[model samples]
Target chain A: MDRVSLIDRVSQGMKNLLVLMLVLLTGCAQQQLRGTGDLGVVIERAAGRIVVVDSSAHATLGTVEGLGDLSHASVVFSRDGRYAYVFGRDGGITKVDLLTQNIARRVVQAGNSIGGAISQDGRLVVAQNYEPGGIKVFDAETLELLADIPSTFGNNGQRSKVVGLADLPGNRFAYALFEAGEIWVADLSDPKHPQLTKYCDIGRQPYDGLVTPDGRYYLAGLFGEDGIALVDLWKPEQGARKILAHYGRGEEKLPVFKMPHLRGWAVAGGRAYLPAVGRHEVLVVDTSTWQEVGRISVKGQPVFVMARPDARQVWVNFAFPDNGWVQVIDTLDNRLIDTLAPGKAVLHLEFTPKGEQVWISARDDNRVMIYDTLTRKPVGELPAQSPSGIFFTSRAGRIGF
Target chain B: MKSLCLLMCFSLAMQASAQSTAEPTPARQHELIRLVRQDCGSCHGMTLKGGLGLPLLPDSLRDKPASSLAATVVHGRPGTAMPPWKTILAEGEAEWIVSRLLTGFPKE
Candidate 1:
């Protein structure tokens, strides 16, 4: 053969070898293509780590560490459910990749933080800090600082610890100040020039806040008083109004072991199920009228009154001495139906995407218990180190998760 | 013989004083550390740098009187979210927690 033809044959052979090597490399690496919808993270608070688990398989995939002070950790997922942005107690924001089960990016943005929220369009991640109280917004992709809106109040312009930060439509955020007793709605459409609407004197010490599932109403739970401050997103000119203003009136308040969380306010059957502060009862209010409709007596001071996906049943967890027990409330009848002892110090509960199973994190027991929603029996268990929060990818599609 | 008797008396006095102070057992101390790091950590923060509550770090608490801190832990501060721990802790245990807070809390 001529020299030119021989060179052509050699180049063709090299191309064939390259294709074969590519196939072998992919196969040998054992890279499995999968979706992240069934994946979730369990916050190991004491260990400052997160265990990524697959709900469909009931198995842990991998563990990611180096997250500092996850004692009050909360997580929000990317729109695609491929990433989890964990907000740590020490103001560390960690972005973990669900597919790779590793940290994508991490930043300690503040001295202290309570929780955080992702903007409506999923372009911004906001952390509410407690040290120099304010909400710092960041670019979701790079975790770069986009804006810093200090929660300044009072005559001296002292910053107040921000709480109950939630996302609204059109790239806006609604949060309450625990020390200032004020609620502020920030329009971050133009992250740099944020248009802020402040509502003052909402109540004394509004400990936490939450936005309705529809993103139309913002509610702040008062710690210093006996009511909830409600703001209609559509009607900002009217300001906030107090609902259930006399919830604990005429009754001596019991010592609250833990502050009831308002973030998980249950809305089922057109009624909102809320935990009455310092009371062993769940208050039901008509969402349309924002009026008290009923109250169900529970085992202890309810910490999380969360509704199942279908809104047919609500699960309630307690604080302190009663934390070991979990109760089920039938929303149709508005009555306590069943109670089960999951484990010691049950810290949190999360329902599956379809609400077939519920995961309960028992911190002291160092395990997470999964129970069938219909049968109300323990179906599975996963060991963890002081797990506090269980977040599923399904939250990625929900508003105000 | 006289010196031995005096040594015995001194040892007895030390034991009596230690009993009066009522230091918790090692196991109980472990539980207390976990409780303060996790439960009280809910408000004061896990590292005790504070969240909704004031910082429990040694520097922040050193200036405060140990007895007052213990009393606050046992009886809780009225009109605030701080609830009385008397239901779960005794006076001595509260004092022990206060002392630990003043000198840096232990890790779990």
Candidate 2:
């Protein structure tokens, strides 16, 4: 064995080892390369877990568990769509990583929480709580507490439950105080010191609220009365005004089995489709004038009146008993075009990014039903355990979700 | 002997009136469990710790009279959002639910 030949063989072995390491690294990178744009999460209410789903594939990717008290869980996607902030009924806020299919961080922020919202800049996450009755702002990345604003009202300093939390432009959040009957805007431009704008006496019992797509208006649905309280974000000095007041026409209201959810998608084609508090009808209001333009009778008390992405159609799901049915209305004609029973106890629904398909959660049946919006036919289904609240990554880019 | 017989008959009547004609079948009991866990769980927390409505935990309900609780379930509190369940629940089912809620609701 000559010295030059021995040295050549040793260098060749070193080269081979480097090649092997390169192959292993590329394999690991390939596993994490997929984009999260088509990802979403479905809450398995009874199990206290979330099933991460891929909308493009029409399949569930993975399940993340150990989220406490998810019975009324709502999820919000981070700006990059890589993380989903789940707000649980037990006041737990869990940040789940979509790529890793695991909980990145979990914190029980309060005794009980309703839902949450992410700031416009995506730097902060806010949880609306029922126990301490306030909004707690957290650092989105580390889940560290940043600010706590109690919904305190009255001379006795009673804290009101915060509802209808939605992020607005300029790093602000607008929410309603259920007991105080007020709408407040929290400006977090200075994350350390939050500036508050309070609008008092908005209406009686603002159950939930929604911000328009343009980020110009915030509307709160009054459960104690027959009207909606509207605040134009562009002109806060004008204060909140009641719209569609006395919509019941002095008639007694039917028993509302479940509270209706208000969201920005309720607006379609310059018309907002709102569920009448206790009536089996959906009130159509002209967005410009905020007047009750028409009423479309429905099967049962509507729980969620949402619009498709293109603003061409509106979909409605009813409360129990009638909850097994879903109704669709064509925006152009503003008439009931189709009525379909997707499954038993349809708890929630979410549309795809382009609005071609919609996913409906049938909690009692333990399955998520997918349907073709254009044909109004069942296209696919995914089995879930007592599913509720289907959320998609597309919400990350929207002003209010 | 006559007075003793009368007392026994009155007790029998009370027991018969306190319960439905017959105990709910096992299948009906399962349905009732789901209704209370999911539907009623909406306002009261699923764990029954409470949300928009008052908590229905055993401790919270133990002090209240079972009869009054059952009546509230059947008729509902008028001013509040609790809607009467007379249309959905059968006779004496409310009483059954009150008894169950007072003893810690079943998980299933």
Give the best candidate by lDDT.
Answer: 1
* Model 1, span A31-101: residue lDDT tens: 68789999999999988999999999999999999999898999999999999999999999999998887
**What are the lDDT scores of the predictions, listed in order?**
0.92, 0.91
Write candidate 2's Cα lDDT for A1-401 as tens digits: 99999999999999999999999999898586789989999999999999999998988889999999998889998999999999999999999999888899999999988999999999999999988999999999999999999999999989998999999999999999988999999999987799999999998889899999999999999988889999999988898999998899779888877888896458888899999998999999999999989999999999999999998999999998789999999989899999999989998899999899999999989999999999999999999999999999999999987
lDDT of 1 by residue, B1-108 (tens): 999999997986566456645787688799999889888988998888888889999999888899899989989999888999998987777888998988889988
Badly placed stretches (over 4 Å) of model 1 are A1-30, B1-20
In model 2, where do residues sit more than 4 Å from their true spots?
Answer: A1-30, B1-22
Docking class of 1: medium
Q: Would you estimate the TM-scores of all the predictions?
A: 0.92, 0.92
lDDT of 2 at A203: 83
What is candidate 1's TM-score for chain A? 0.94
| DockQ, candidate 1, vs. native dimer | 0.65
Q: Report how far residue A241 has shifted in candidate 2, in Å.
A: 1.0
